[model samples]
Target: MELTNYLGLAAILFAIGSATVLLRRNSIVVFMGIELMLNATNLVLVTFARMHGDITGQLLAFFVMVVAAAEVVVGLAIIITIFRARRSASVDDVNLLQS
Candidate 1:
């Protein structure tokens, strides 16, 4: 496949992820959407690494994966805490930070 094809797929995934984050009210679903976006970015990074014949992009993708994993850990912990507190995981119900 061509590089453009990979880029297009990445773009599509990113768009879907963005839409999910914007349109969903559930915190878990939003978290999944964020993960999807991160994966899409990884795809683009890998594609660029292959196109440029260098390991830098791949290394960056690896770091991104690590960060994403950490994000998942922390995000889930927060979500679980919120659920335990309120018995609900809806983003709309999380207004504690509001002034």
Candidate 2:
């Protein structure tokens, strides 16, 4: 398979992830969407790095993975906390504006 195939797949994944984030209301789904998007980005980065015969893109992907790990930790904690307080995972149900 050509390297372009990887890029195309990454684009499709990113689009789906974006749609999930935009169309879904469940906090967990949105978080998964975000993770999907991040993975797509990593795919693109790694593909480019392979095509270029350079380590830059792979290095960037590694950093991105580290950030993603941190995000998973923090994002899940927030989701759990919200679910506990609101008893619902819908984004609309979270009304922080209320006094």
Candidate 3:
């Protein structure tokens, strides 16, 4: 196919990810949705890089991946800590803003 096809796919994936983030109450699921969104963004970047014949987009995509990896590490650790304390992974149960 074409770049448009890839872009469309990325859009759909992003929409699904957004929906998951909005609707899901589980912390792990929400994190998964965020990761999905990041992957969709990377897909778009790679597609644009291919269309433009430039390395910038690909480099950006790589950077995004690295950031996503770090986020996953930190995010999961926080989630695990919350789960250990609350015994539930529900996002609503997390109230870090509260003292």
Candidate 4:
């Protein structure tokens, strides 16, 4: 497959993820959208790394994966806390800071 094909797929994935984040109200769904976006970015990085014949992009993708894993840990903890407090996981329901 050509590099452009990979790039196009990545773009599509990113768009879908962005739409999900914008249109969804559930916190967990939004988190999944964010993860999808991150994966799309990783795909682009890997494609570029392959095109350039270098390991840097792949290494960066690995770093992104590590950060994403940490994000999942912290994000899930926060979501679980909110769910326990209100029994709901909707983003609109999380207006704790609104004064």
TM-score per candidate, chains pooled: 0.94, 0.94, 0.93, 0.95
Off by over 4 Å in 4: none
- Any residue pairs clashing in model 4, and if so which? none
Q: List the residue pairs that clash in candidate 3.
A: none
lDDT digits (tens) for residues 1-99 of candidate 2: 899999999999999999999999999999999999999999999999999999999999999999999999999999999899879999999888999
Please report, in order, the local distance difference test score of every candidate based on alpha carbons: 0.96, 0.97, 0.96, 0.97
Candidate 2 — what's its lDDT?
A: 0.97
lDDT of 4 by residue, 1-99 (tens): 679899999999999999999999999999999999999999999999999999999999999999999999999999999999899999998887988
Q: What RMSD value applies to candidate 1?
A: 1.1
Candidate 2 lDDT for residue 88: 97
RMSD of each: 1.1, 1.5, 1.7, 0.9
Clashes of 4: 0
Give candidate 1 misplaced runs (Cα > 4 Å): 96-99
Per-residue lDDT of candidate 3, residues 1-99 (tens digit): 768999999999999999999999998999999999999999999999999999999999999999999999999999999889889999897778997
Clashes of each: 0, 0, 0, 0
lDDT of 1 by residue, 1-99 (tens): 689899999999999999999999999999999999999999999999999999999999999999999999999999999999999999999988977
Candidate 1 accuracy as lDDT: 0.96
Question: TM-score order of candidates, best first?
Answer: 4, 1, 2, 3
lDDT of 4: 0.97
What residue runs in model 2 are displaced by over 4 Å at the alpha carbon?
A: 96-99
Cα lDDT for residue 77, model 3? 96
